[model samples]
Target: MSKTSTPGQIRRLTKAHKMSFAAVATIGAAALAATLVPAGTADAGTTVAAAPVAWTQAVEGVQAKTVQHLSMQSKLATDAAKLEAAVKAKAAAAAAKAKADAEAAAKAKKDREAKAAASRSTVRKPVYANNLDGWIKESLAIMKAHKIPGTYNGLYKNIMRESSGNPRAINNWDINAQNGVPSKGLLQVIKPTFLAYHVPGTPLDQYHPVANIVAAANYAADRYGSIDNVNSAY
Candidate 1:
């Protein structure tokens, strides 16, 4: 039998057909877009644009790290250079101080040696005198050094008898004078006799009281054992 559709049923059937058609149209539009564009071409534009930014950020991070490392290396090099310079400066100062100390020590040693040499030189010199008694004492000291035995009493007695204590006495009329060699001085020693018995440290001039006494005493000690042995004029 043929049946007629009610109005509510006809409306519901038309709504279902319309909804199906819209869904099919949307699927066909998506299919057509996929056919027109390449497989990954649609997202490639976005990826290409974002890739540069990401690469730039990564490079910038690497550059920052490299720059930081370079800065640290530069600081370390500077610190190392400063330390080396400080060590060199300290070594130089120590060397300079050692050199100065060595020089000072050498100077001190030289000064001490010079002073010691001066002292040694001073110790060897004999005392000087300029009088009869001073000459006698000086002669006595020299005689003591030479081990020649004589006393002041013997010397005075002999000098008084020989020339009456005259330091410049001359015997021009004696046998020695006739031979042109006059006995002279306190002990009346001839030039030959005085020169023969001249003692070291005594004056060369026989007229000198000390020179006369020392020569006479030397002669008497050599010929008669000692000046002290001659109690009278010798």
Candidate 2:
């Protein structure tokens, strides 16, 4: 006759089967619990499945990080471009100011130089010790006494060209050449001419520039056609 198992044995076997099922479920939920077959019946089994995975949270985090990085990079690029443009504009403005300043300085310098030159030309000239009026008066008296033709201008020009109006003009060697004799004074009046034509108040030695010039005027008028022609060496 079939005997019933003790309670402890039956309890132990049930406990073991529960532990095995728990272990199997932990490893893979797809594994199914096996059923005990009775007399001639076939054994049947069932399986448990694992839960589905969710991807929404992880994918959103990655996308958000990527967008933040792109935004930061875009801002940096824009700021860099703006900074470069500002620098270039500042440099151009500085260059323009420098050029303007240089041009203004140059113009001012040129104007100053021109003004100085004009002042010098207008306000400066040499002064003579002997006044021009006195020389003219003395020259006129000589011309009248000598009976020389032409205006006093001729006498003035001749005297200036000959000795620059130096009254001490002399040619002692005129004695040797006989071309001129002891011709002294401004006009270089020869000794013979001075003696013959000496004026009443004038001495024979009145070979002074004024005296000589008067005597030369009369001699030039008698010999040469005119004072102008004499000046031309005729």
- The TM-score values for the models, in the order shown, are 0.62, 0.37
lDDT of 2 at 185: 67
Q: lDDT for every model?
A: 0.83, 0.65
- TM value for model 1: 0.62
Q: Tens-digit lDDT track for model 1 on 1-234?
A: 889999999999999999999999999976665565556566643532223446779999999999999999999999999999999999999999999999999999999999999998885756757755666677777888878888887777787788887787999998899999999988889999999989887789979888888888889999898777887645
Model 1 misplacement above 4 A: 1-54, 57-61, 95-128
| lDDT score for candidate 2 against the true structure | 0.65
Q: How far is candidate 1 from the true structure (C-alpha RMSD, Å)?
A: 9.9
lDDT of 2 at 215: 65
Cα-based RMSD of the predictions, in order? 9.9, 18.0
Instruction: Please write out the lDDT profile of model 2 over residues 25-52, one tens digit for every residue.
Output: 8766432212222344543553333233
After aligning candidate 1 to the native by TM-score, how far in Å is the CA of 174 from where it should be? 1.5
